[model samples]
Target chain A: MKLTIQNLTYSINDTVIVSDVGLNIKKGEFVGLIGPNGCGKSTLLKNIYRVLSPDAGSIYLDETDIRTMKSKELARKMSVMIQENNVEFDMNVLDMVLLGRYAHKKMLGNMTPEDYEIARKALEEVGMAEYEERSFLSLSGGEKQRILIARVLAQQTDFIILDEPTNHLDIQYQFQIMDILKSQDATVFSSVHDLNIAGYYCDRIIVMKKGRIIHCGAPEEVLTSQIIDELYHIRSEIRENKYTGRKQVYYIPNSANISTCAVTENL
Target chain B: MAAAGFAAMIAAMLLGSVGIQPDWVVKILANHLSRHNIFSPEWEANKEAIIWTLRAPRVVMAYVTGAGLSLCGILMQALTKNSLADPYVLGISSGASSGAVAVICYGWFRFAGAYHIMFGATLGAILAIVIAMKVSSVSNKVTATQLVLAGIAVQAMFSAITNAILYSSTTTSDKLRSAMHWMVGSLASASWNTTVYVLIISLVCTVIIRLFHTELDVLMLGDDTASTLGINLRQVKIGVIVLCTALTGSIVSIGGVIGFVGLLVPHITRSIVGSAHKRLIPASVLTGGFFVVICDMLARILAAPEELPIGVITSFFGAPFFLFLIRKSRNSFGGKNG
Candidate 1:
C-alpha cells in the first residue's frame, strides 16, 4: 500500500502543531520519522492514522482519499501501534490480541477457529506465543510491547504505523523489536528517538522541525552532523562504526571540546 | 446464576409477613402460567391475593430493576473505560432524586397523579445527561475523565437542590416519609403495571446491548485504539450513553435510587466471567437480579411487618462484600500500580 500525505496541517487551540507536511511512502519501504521533542512527528502520524482530523490538505492511501473512508474500512488496510500503555481493565494477552480481528467481525459475530488460529500465529510471530494466557498488566514493558506488536500482526493490514514503538526498551529488546518490524512484508512508518537505530533500519528517513518536513532521504544523506546539530541544538559527529559499518552519532559535551583542544598539540 | 435468581424470586414471594407455603406459591404461579382454574378454589383468598397480586409484582420488579441497572453499569464502565463507573456515576440518580423530591414537596405535577413522579424522574435524568455531555465535550470529543468530572459536578448541584427542597418543605409527615423512603430506594410500591413495563424495557435493552458486545470490548482499549480498530468512537459513545440513560432513567423512575447493586454486581460478574461482554452481560443480569431479590427478601423479613429500605440493606451488605472481593483480587483491581 502506498501512503501519500500532501500539505497536511493540524492545529490545537489555534496554535499550529503540524504545518504543511507532505511525504510519499512506497509499498514495503521502511520509513523513519525523526525530529526533536516537540517537532509534531507524533501529531503527523496521528493525522495519518485518523486519530485526529487534519486542519488542511489531504491524505491518500493508494488512490483513495482517507477522509472518505469508514474507520473499519481504513483499519482493514492499515494498523496503528500507539504509545499509550494504560489498561484500566484486566485482560489477558489472547483476549487483547483477539480484539485485532474486530474489523473482520460482524456486530455479534463469534470468534471462529480461524480467528484463534490467526491470533496464535501472530503471537508466535512476535515470540510471545507462550504468554497467551498471561495477564496483560502483569507483563513487563518489553513483553507488553511484543504482545502489542503481535496484536498489530493479527490485524494483518497492508500498512502499519508505529509511534515510538521502541521508546523505553533495553538495547537487546529494542533491537529485537526493530528486527521484527524490519522483517515484516508490510509498508512500515515509524517515529524513532534513537537516530542510530533509525539509521540502521530505515530505507529512507524524513526529518521534521517545527511541524514542517526539513529533509527526506537515505540515512547517509539526511543524517549529517550539521543537520543533527541544528535540529537538536547539540554538537555531534556522525562516524561509521568499524564493526558494523553503520553511521553512529557521538555527541560532544561542553568539556569534551576543551579536552580535544588540549590533545591537539600531541596530534 | 439464572437458576439461583429464579429460586430467589420464588422465595421472595413466599416469605412475606403473611407467610405462604412454597407449595402453594408454586401452585399459584403454575396455575397462572397454565391459565388453569384448578388451584383457584382450593387456595385461601387472602394468601392467594398476597402471593399473586402483591408479592409477585414486587419480586418481579426487583428482578427487572437489578437486571436493568447492572446492564447500565457494564455499559457505563465500558463507555468511560473505568471499572469504578456505575449507572449512577453520571448523575442520573441524583437528578432523578431531585425531580422526585421537587414533586413530592411542592406538588409540581399533581395533575399526573400516579405517573407524576415517573415523569419528573425521567425528565430530570435526561436533562442531567444532556447537560453533562454538553459540558464535558470539546471539539466533539468526549473523554472519560472529563465526562466523569462533569457528572460529579452535575450530581453535586442536583443534590443541593434536592436538599433545599427537602429542608424548605412544610409538607405533612406522610409525604415526608414517602419522599425519604423513595430516596433510600424501596420496592414497597411495586405494582403489576410497573413490573410489566420494566420487564419489557429491560429485555429490549439487554438484547440491543448484547449486539454491541464486541464494540464494548474494543472500547475498553480507549478511543485512539478503538478508532484504529475500525470503530467510530464518537458514534459508539453516543449510542451507548443514550441507551444507558434510557435504561437507568426507567429503573430510577420505577424503583427510586437503588445504589450499590449496579456498582457491585458488574464487578463481581467481571471477576467471575472475565471481561468478555458476551458472558459478562448475561452473568451480570442474573447475578444482579439474584442479589436484589435476596436483599429485598432480607429487607422484608429482617424487620417483619415494618419493612426496611432495600437500599440500606444492599449498601450494608454490599460494601463489606465488595471490600472482601477487592482484597481477594488485589492485583486485578490495583489500577496502574498493579
Candidate 2:
C-alpha cells in the first residue's frame, strides 16, 4: 500500500528531465507534489504511473518492483486520473464509466449488476447520478473532471494518483474535487497548482525544484514564504486565517526579491 | 434479423426479370443440390441453366460481397477510430482500380485467367496498405489522422497514374468501358466458384472480429488506457489492419470498388445500439450483410437487362443517408464535418 521511488532518472535526448528523484507515499496518507511550472512534477508522476519509464531507477509498490507486475495486476492495485483526457467519441456517461470495469470483468462475460452498482455508486458520489444518460461530450469542464474521477473510483483500487485533477475547474468545484479526494480512504497522491489546496489536503508535501526534491516535510515546514519565493521567484506574504488559524499564501505580483528556481531542469 | 436478411434475399431473387416460376427455380436448385431430379423433367431441363448457372451464382456473389464489404467497413472504423475510415479510406480501392485497369488495357488474359484482373486488384490493394502503413508509422505511434492523410495521398497518386495509362493506351474503347465498369464495382462477373471462397473468408473474418470485440472496445479509449488495461495496442492495431485489408481487398478484387458501406454501416449500427463493441460489431456485421444484399438486389432489378454497378447503388443510398445522419447528429461526433 506504499509507493517508493529511489534515485529515479529519465532523460530525453540526453537532457535530464528528472534526475535522482526520490519520494514515498505511505499507506492511507495523502501526499502532494508541488513545484513551479515545468518543474518535473508531471514527469516524475508519469514515471511512477508507468506512462513513462525512468532511464535509471526503481519504483517499488510495497515489496515488489512495479516494473515486474503485469499491467492488469497493477491496474487492479492502483488507478490514475490524468489531465489531458479529451475524447472524440460521443460515449454515454454510463458507458464511459463502465469502461473502468473493463479490467475487472472477463473479456467474454456479460456485465453483471454488481458492475452497474459500482458505476452507479461512483457516479452518485460525484453528484453525477442524474447525468448518467447524458452524452459525455456535452458536460462542462468540472463535470467532465468529476466523471473522470468517477471512472477512477469505479476502478476500485487501493491507491489513486491524480495529475492536476482540477486544472480547469472554478473555485467551488475545485474545493469539491479536492474534498472528495481528501475523503477517500485510499492512499492519494496528487500534483497541484494551488499550494493552499495542497496544504489543506496533503498529509505531507514534496516540493521539487529543477527535477529534484528541494523540500519534503509537513506543509507548514516546506511552504514557508522564503521557500515559496525561492522556488517560484515571486514574493508572497504568508499569514494564518483569523478564525481557523490555517496558513495561507498571498503573493505580491512582480516582486523583485524572489529568485525563481528553474527546478524543472533536473527533471 | 438473420431470418429477415434471408427473406429479403429470397424476395430479391424472386422479383427479378423473366419472372421464373418459383417451382422451376426450386426444381433447378434441387436438381443441382441433389445431383438428381425428382421433379417434372420439362421444367427442370429448361430452367436449370438459367437459374443454377447464371442468376443464382451472381445473387450469392452479391450477398457475399455486400456482407464482406460491410464487415470490412465496421472493422476499419473501429481500427482507425474514425467513422469516415473505410477500405477506401486507406486508398486500397484506388490502388485496386489502377491494377484492374492495367490488366484490362494490357489484355493480361492471354497470360492470366479472366479472374487475373481480381488477383491483380488484390495485389494492388495489399501494396497500397503496406505503403500507407510504412509512410504513416513515424516513431512508435500511428495516428489515425496521419493514416487517413497518407491514404488520401496514395489514392490521388494511383488515380493519376491510372488516368495517364488510360490516355496513352491504344486499347479499344470497349476495353476502356469495361475497365470503367469494374471501377464502379460489380457482382456481374461473380460465379459459383467465387461465392464459396468469399462466403468462407467473410464469415470467418466476421467471427474473429466479433470474438475480439472486448479488445476493440478498449482500443476506443486510446492507446495509453488500452495499454494500462494490459492490452498491447500496437499488436492489436496491426492485427486489425491486416484482417481489414485482406477481407476488403479480396472483396474489392472481385466486386470492384464499392465505397461507403464501411463508413455508413457502423454509423447506423452505433445509432441503433450504443458504442459498446460487443453489440456494435455483431450488429454492424449483420446489418452490413443485410444492407449489401438489398443493394445488390437493387442493382440487379433497377436496370433490368443491363446490370448497374453495386457501388452506384450503395452511393445512391449511402450518400443521402450520410447527409441525413450528419444533419440529424449535428451536435454529435459526426458533426465535425462542418
Best by TM-score: 1
Interface RMSD after interface superposition, model 1: 1.8
| C-alpha DockQ of every model | 0.62, 0.30
Give per-residue CA lDDT, model 1, range A40-116, as digits (tens).
Answer: 99999999999899999999999999999988899999999986565667778898899999888776787788989
> What interface RMSD does each of the candidate structures achieve?
1.8, 2.9
How would you encode candidate 2's per-residue C-alpha lDDT over B97-156 as one tens digit per residue? 777677766776446575676666666777777777687555534455566578779878
Alpha-carbon runs more than 4 Å astray in model 1: A255-267, B38-41, B97-120, B133-152, B160-171, B317-338
Query: How far is A222's C-alpha from truth in model 2 (Å)?
Result: 2.7
Fnat for each predicted structure, in order: 0.78, 0.25
Query: Candidate 1 A-chain TM?
Result: 0.95
Clashes of 2: 9
Q: Give the CAPRI class of candidate 2.
A: acceptable
Deviation in Å, model 2, residue B331 alpha carbon: 12
Q: What global local distance difference test value does model 1 have?
A: 0.83
